[model samples]
Target: MSYTPLVDAEGFAAFPAPAKLNLFLHIVGRRADGYHLLESIFQLVDAHDTVWLRVRDDGQIVHHNPMPNVPAETDLTVRAAKLLQTATGVSYGVDIRVDKRLPMGGGMGGGSSDAATVLLALNRLWHVNWQRQALMDLGLQLGADVPFFIFGRNALVEGIGEIMTPIETEATDFVVLHPPVHVPTPAIFGDPELTRNTPSLKVSLLEGTADWRVLRNDLESVAVRKYPQIAQHIQWLSQYAPARMTGSGSCVFAAFVAKDVEKNTSQNQANAVIFGLPKEMSGFVTSSLQEHQLLGFASD
Candidate 1:
């Protein structure tokens, strides 16, 4: 499935908002303002949510289908469009509709990615023509993870996700399991047991290293204690490969590397894992994305 924008008969452009897997998340330090500094490798994946947008000359931004319990005004997608309108003073508004496939609070960056897609899509729909960095700057105000999605590639993310450095990652297949629980990020961060002192890895060191398998999410332990379902999911998936929780919690994934000359082997392995999942468990197989679908929408 291509991430390119597709226009339907009614003139709504459907944009893909791909999800991200934190290959590993580390809480490096905390700021005076209570924001936790982080270091992580953010890997884009094919698993995504789609946002349908249509330019409105009337200057009224509206979400056609807002998530239940989340007001349209407070929704990130709407907020992103409004922010772009306010920033560039673009007279055009947007009618937004999100087809959400990624799980909420699953640490898959669903909402943040949705917001980034909105920013990128509206930049073109409204003729703002802002550079990618400018959009990223605007995205940071929405959420820390938003900028990385706008960055549009596998990245070494640091400093509360405001800093990103594009990194090379192998095209690998993964089986992602989503435990049926919403792990509140604030609760995880506020927990006294959360590790906030992991020694930061220099970007140079990361670039020099050939193997990233040793790195782990420092928040996993804290999350597992708070949400036992996450631990259960991780334990079950680990049987196939060394599985770890992505980002804060709920979704755990295990990479399946292709062996020999067979490229489909990894994907087949991932599918097999998903096929064997227990009755109550749910998951899907997805491959890493080289870059975001909307990467070229914004200028350099």
Candidate 2:
């Protein structure tokens, strides 16, 4: 149910790079190497960046429209393409065009998802046919979060970000608010005041026993203290639901579930937040996706 292996009408292979929310991020400990051990629920959402790729035989990686202020070489999508080519020794290349709708540095996992998309798409486009685990291993070289996106499901992630256990989730909605400033992950992780010893959680986020309202993001304290804009956005959203920061975030969101989706109440709730937001803040209402669009692309 995850992948449809066909090029679209535009004659380009279109792939979706979806966004994710850390329902709650807990820092359990730190590894000997300095990477923080984490326990988090990663929920995939409908909000996404779209990657359109056309394979080339000449062994060149290209981004048709790179993001502003980001060098084409440094773009994760481009890097992903080149890395896959080099690692697999493939003769094929790609012309990638990105339609970016997610916020950069908002802790929504935009860049990581884009990189996953390229790896997944090209595995299909170039006929490299790597297994999902192999692709996930390659993805880790790009970023810690990259493997989760490649895993392509709602997941419970732990360890230094590579350990993943896919969990079930129903279709859900959220009002995601992106504040104007960037909250650097290093700044949040490096803060001395950040809690590094939150006890581990064992409940299943999929089983309805884990009350998200009681769960908390340990990084939130550090990020909110450093960025007032993020704090303000969280405060505004708190009026409607239990607002929480996602990842080391400048964006905050509140989840909404439906008794009957036919009623369309969740979407309205998301819209209410959007309509009431001040012009300085940006946001959208989005629903969760059960699987990544390229979920079956890899040989699982």
Tell me, by lDDT, which candidate is best. 1
Candidate 1, pairs of clashing residues:
none
Give a tens-digit lDDT track for model 2, residues 1-300. 756645777677778899999988999999899889999989999899988899888988878898788899999999999999999999998998998999999899999999999999888888999999999999999999999988998888999889898887767789999988988799899999989998877565556688666899999988888988889999989999899899999889998886569998888887887899888778898898877888888978
lDDT of the structure predicted as candidate 1: 0.89
Off by over 4 Å in 1: 1-4, 203-205, 259-263
Task: Put down candidate 1 lDDT per residue, 1-300, tens digits, no spaces.
Answer: 244668999889999999999888889999999999998889999999999999988999989999999989999999999899899987888899999999898999999999999999888778889999999999999998899999998988888778888888888898999999988888999999888998878555467663556789999998899889999999999898999999887899999865632658889888989889999999999889989989989978
lDDT of each: 0.89, 0.88
TM-score, structure 2 vs. true: 0.95
